[model samples]
Target: MTAPQRARSAQPALDRVDRRILDHLADHGRSSIADLAEAVSISASSAQRRLRRLESEEVVRGYRAVLDPIAVDRGLVVHLAVTLVDHTTNTVGRFERHVLDLAGLVSCHHVTGDVDYLMRVDVADVEALDVLLRRTLARLPGVARLTTMVATSAVVDRVTQV
Candidate 1:
């Protein structure tokens, strides 16, 4: 209905302390308040207050345990590059709605260049991936072409750092 209200600038004004807190939290999401305080060289109360502020500001967002793909029966990782038929808002919106609801989806980016979207998904195996491609991804709204690449192994798979 309406465009998102973006911040005044691209980057948030994070001081050294805030940076340290974020960096520490990025690596250790389940760390206690005392642990975080010690890591960032701040008092427990200060660390807590800052963490609360970060949460309220929607910077830290939420936390969850990172699961191993093989352990979870989702070891097959695939990247799907999508080329849309056109760049109409209606088409893109429809596509996004469908994509976000897809099972096994890790992430999706509305990217630039030759393709309209670049999406990463994890499935049980090749059969599951085939179904996702043929029955799901290929049938999305305004889809023109689909290019897929299955990851053999991850050389540098890690969570994003602050």
Candidate 2:
């Protein structure tokens, strides 16, 4: 998966210690305070305090274990570009609400393009995808069109440190 492009305005300046801490955590979220402190050349207590501050400030949101889709029986992954017939707020809200209800939807983004929304969906096979497209997505009110493209492979899937 490609990293979501972040706006430059949303980023804040990082001190050297902050950079080091982030780099260490990026390499291993399970790293203990002592290990992180040693890597960053700081006291364990200091490292713990810094970590707490980062979490409190929403810099470190949460940790997750990355899983293989095939192992989980959800191998077929597709990207869908959706365009709504109406651009009204109510219509968009209704569509978004319905999209959120679908089980296969992994991520949805309101983007700039011919399509108003981009959705990432994962299913077991093409049959499930057809059901999702015809029954769920196509049935959405005010939906003009939806274009889907299956992903063959993920080239880079890394979260930026900092």
- For each candidate in the order shown, give its overall lDDT on alpha carbons: 0.88, 0.83
Task: Give residue 5's lDDT in candidate 1 (0 to 100).
Answer: 41
Q: How well does model 2 score by local distance difference test?
A: 0.83
TM-score (C-alpha, index-matched) for candidate 2 = 0.81
Worst 10 residues of 1 by lDDT: 1-10
Estimated TM-score for each candidate = 0.87, 0.81
lDDT of 2 by residue, 1-162 (tens): 234446454555668998899988886898999999999999999999989888877788888666677777577888899999989999999998888888867899999979999988888889988888888889998799999999777776452221
Tell me the spans in candidate 1 whose CA falls farther than 4 Å from its real position.
1-6, 9-12, 159-162
Per-residue lDDT value at 34 in model 1: 100
Considering summed lDDT, which 10 consecutive residues are worst modelled in model 2? 1-10
What total of clashing residue pairs does each candidate reach?
A: 0, 0
